[model samples]
Target: MKSTRDTHRFSATTSRFLLPTFRRPCYLDIIKTNVPKSLNKSNIFHKWTEEGQAPYYTIINDALLSDNYNILNQNMIYINNLREAIKENLHQDSIKVYRNLKFCSTYVKDEYKEGMTFLWPTFSSTSRNKDVASTFGNYTFEINASTNDFTYRTDISMYSKYSYEQEVLFYPYSGFRVKKIIPDARIIQLECVDTIEVESNSRILVPEQVKIFDAERKMFVYFYKDNEDLHWSHADTPDQMYLIGQNMNGYWDSHYRYHHSNGYFVHKGNNLWEEYQNEQFHASFQQI
Candidate 1:
């Protein structure tokens, strides 16, 4: 019989939790504590090290309509149809959630006859004003089918350059005292959210910007910027991109408040290929 320790071969990647390594002290008088070390240096471990861990966020609300829920509850027809279509297109297994992001679902759109694509509420805040909120943190997801797979790349830029004035709520501990204050601050620097390359058998059209909503003379727009390297010559199926940003304030303690933007991009169609390149696109974000 194998020993317990032997049964757990050190693997840096496949292991879901942390594995600290033992090492000799580098200095005579100094000590290092809590240094996470894992075995086998696998892809998963490397990802955690480089990007930190994926965060758990609150699911603010439900995602689907009652009719859709009834359909799924009564039978597997819709799901089965979608699975078969995607499988046929990708020549592989059925669709599976990519990175296990907070909320993800699939629906059959009229445009997609064989199968549907994945959808997620891109941002946490619903403010239509670009100056209302911002988001930070970086994560990548990959969805697999039978023979092929596609990666949904999300890179939220926490650093840009923008300043605005907004009302803030100050919380006082030990009581229900609420204070409102307006301050001129760079709620968040303007950040760029661009969708990475996708991979699949079908034509996955990149996202385009539209005037989503406007109120009180404030305009909120969703637009795509073409990958500069790819000129208009490739318009129909050109390498595309989209940019969005917002500002909001979060308060946890009476003395502290945090401000950031919520901006992101998701591919619009089926399994296309988005290269998981590690190239740095811009300067590092300054934590707020």
Candidate 2:
């Protein structure tokens, strides 16, 4: 994820007072009466979808897009609570959602060409009603997604203040592939996919021998061929090894983190491996 300043700015002085406003009795009463009691304990979902006056959604999303650890850390409790609420309310089947944005620049239309894959680094709010989405802007995104896919999304309509909009919330770091673009309609069609799937589709070739410095572990890791299979060994635990194999797509990947985990690392190139877990970038190993 990359850091971006909030394009829509509020007064810095008043912004500090916004969060505490949610603690008021009126806000609590509204949440308690409207949302499920179990999920409303923290009122995170209500806060997230609240409109006007209390811009919790914008504040939290701005922090996420900022990619500032300190800013994110300050809001982690609310973020985690909201995540748990969404997880509890996750949709069971595939869904279609729409989002409309007023683009100040042509960066999305220009850079995100059809068939290109990209990471949407911040939490996204969408609507099940196309007409409702269109009320926001001309550049509309029509998304096809699966609950079982590599993204965490939930039907937040039941929890939203504006329930008529039929809101659906996608957590941060959702992976998307541009399926098609209708220039005439200003519409972009997107398909949800795993981040690793996108990285593996790259044309970069894996090297026979590779050494990378793991920033998270603060150690050098080595990968080499052994008995016709590629294996990796950490410098701190050289005796322990993990195997890497080519998938049906002919991309090299390894599930070294945990058994039965959907997360893994894919060799994106000779000098780089992209690690994805929980539909997000867990880490990256760069050649040292």
Candidate 3:
């Protein structure tokens, strides 16, 4: 009679999917609402609040590419490299994409004969003829990898200011839409996308200017100004500072658009870290 005893254990580890009684057009669309209150939009701006000041450029810096599909296809050479960088940094057990900007595969080299120092060349993308159409939303960018420096297309163009008559400068939206996203330092144009519609008051995009270190010139840029401070000298990593209230229209700056009644999205690269200390980082995973 050490007799037999029956025991059973049930596990709830099985993965489950959200099943709905009825599905509607883009039913899963609003599901973004269920994201935990912690990871939700409100607390997402943690980096912003921690910062010293919210300059006019309080908006996050998001660099959108005219063609993000290239990334989905892996044909986007630069982005593929960027994806790898993201995977490496997070030390992620696995990359999990839950929402906008899905996580795609990364490109890795097998040969370890030697290490590689990857560098993205910097180039400027600007508007042509000072109009909104050509330069405002979509940029006709010039990739200058050989030099590793990029400038705004308008910077090279004859006209630098915003003009309506000659250059149909497009200004359309509500509250505010980022009109310009400038890199604080010289960096290679890694990846950009055409349009991403985000309807989250908890989160917003801003113009974050960042600069890197240059040995040749002790100071990265001769002169720099943000909404908060006047000058920056440190060169350890990229410094993200903003000078608020100067935009195409609305509260931001001379480049930001308020809100386009037309619903068609212009190019807005969701806030991101252009380079992770000379490396690259994914947007959602990184901070302001």
Q: What are the RMSDs of all candidates, in order? A: 25.2, 13.2, 26.8
Which stretches of candidate 2 lie above 4 Å from their native place? 1-42, 199-288
Model 1 poorest ten-residue lDDT run: 169-178
**Candidate 2 on 159-240: residue-level lDDT in tens?**
6656777877875556788899888788889988775565454314334555666777755555442223445667678678
The 10-residue segment of model 3 with minimum total lDDT is 7-16
Q: For residues 160-183, could you state the per-residue lDDT of candidate 3 as single tens digits?
A: 122221210110111112223223
The count of residue-pair clashes in candidate 3 stands at: 49
Write down the TM-score for model 2.
0.56
lDDT of 1 by residue, 19-113 (tens): 00111112101112232323222322122112213311111011111112332333333222322222233222233211211211221111112
Q: What would you estimate as the lDDT of candidate 1?
A: 0.19
Q: Estimate every model's Cα lDDT from 0 to 1.
A: 0.19, 0.57, 0.20
| Candidate No. with top TM-score | 2
Give the lDDT of residue 30 in candidate 3.
26
